[model samples]
Target: MFKIHEIREIIKLIDQSSIKEFELEIEGSKVTIKKSGGVVEEKVQTIVAQAPAAPVAAAPAPAAQAAPVQPAAQPAANTQVPEENLHQILSPMVGTFYSAPEPGASAFVQVGDKVTPNKVVCIVEAMKLFNEIEAEVTGEIVKVLVQDGQLVEYGQPLFLVKPE
Candidate 1:
């Protein structure tokens, strides 16, 4: 079972660390932590073993069990530069920052790019999932505060936009 305080601590760690993704294996259980848009999300899975009935005691002993496998968690994608002189766009969740949907892909928005409210300017990945972040104000991109794949904290400045 995942405890709320533990999760909060993990989130705080993620916020403070430069690493965007973190994983741990404990007692045959796997835990993964990711931060995006200033939000931290975690996933935990426990592997349980079932004992065989007495009737099977005579059978050859089962091969030694292997260590539990942790699922491959994908980090968040996309980070956009907000314009200067405009309201700064802050991360709402903790996760990895991406400049594009994938490696080698063009970024969603760039410096000098015009943005409007409701336009998806970036994406924050949490818990192996991608979440699109929209621009909340109409403006021109001025600066990018976070680098791609960098871990960000809650309320962290993502971009500085200049109003159009």
Candidate 2:
């Protein structure tokens, strides 16, 4: 019989190693561990695994844009104006977007909320873990680009803000 301490030690060593999966059987007592790299990657992967919709959501935009809309019809001012005044905080990785830390929790930021560069704007829940997404721009949140539980792609815009 493997003691609890021994099992823990095995897990710790397995985590530090490059092996992705581990399984062992001794006298009918079995142990299995599936690793997803180190601690930071595990946290990020926990969220990304649930965001399979990310790629689907990304497709078709370019095709649709190429159909009927003339790029020249959009004035340069309109294209540049918003970007000049507003900054967007984009997702650092693909995940399911969440406005709050947990169910029934108050959202980290709402429309018109003032935020600093390091403020936590929202939490993105991927697999079963919630990763806090921060605001990299000091500004007032003008719009939220994603809904709660929405699947977001890496670099997808989450919030648009009017920079202070």
Candidate 3:
């Protein structure tokens, strides 16, 4: 049987690699893990075998669910300016978005704040991994599209920026 920490370590290692599926069998227990490309959704399956004379059974594990969908509201500023002139900072992976580094802390960037290419604008936590997201461009933040702790999808726009 694999320890909790060992399982976490394995997940971390797999998360950093390009492998899509991983399976391991130890003794009479089997573990199967699967993840999508650029998305953090994970489904883990475990199966246990009984004595040689008995039959093996596989139990289906509960699947991870994405955050509840929120209705999109149009910002007044977006209507005034042409969106073609603005740049969108998209989420690179599926995860929970956090504007602040921690609870009650000031957000990394707010609307009207200037950001450079390497400036960290937020964090996207997936499968217990906190990924720092950068601005990737020099611009003034025009709008924050997602709320804190909201689940974001891959390629979804998180911020709108007006290029400096």
The prediction achieving the highest TM-score against the true structure is 3
lDDT of 3 by residue, 50-118 (tens): 111211133212233222233335431343557799998887766688999999999999888999999
Total backbone collisions for each predicted model: 26, 3, 0
lDDT by candidate, in order shown: 0.59, 0.58, 0.66
lDDT of 1 at 115: 93
RMSD of candidate 1 to the truth, in angstroms, is 17.2
- Show where candidate 1 strays beyond 4 Å: 1-84
lDDT for each residue of candidate 1 in 20-84, tens digit (9 for 90 to 100): 44555666666565434434333347322222222221222111222122221332233343323
Residue runs of model 3 more than 4 Å from their true location after superposition: 1-79
lDDT of candidate model 3 versus the reference: 0.66
Q: Which ten residues in a row have the lowest lDDT in candidate 1?
A: 61-70
Write candidate 2's Cα lDDT for 70-141 as tens digits: 122212122223655788787764457788877899989988789998899998754355788889878888
Each candidate's TM vs. the true structure? Answer: 0.53, 0.51, 0.57
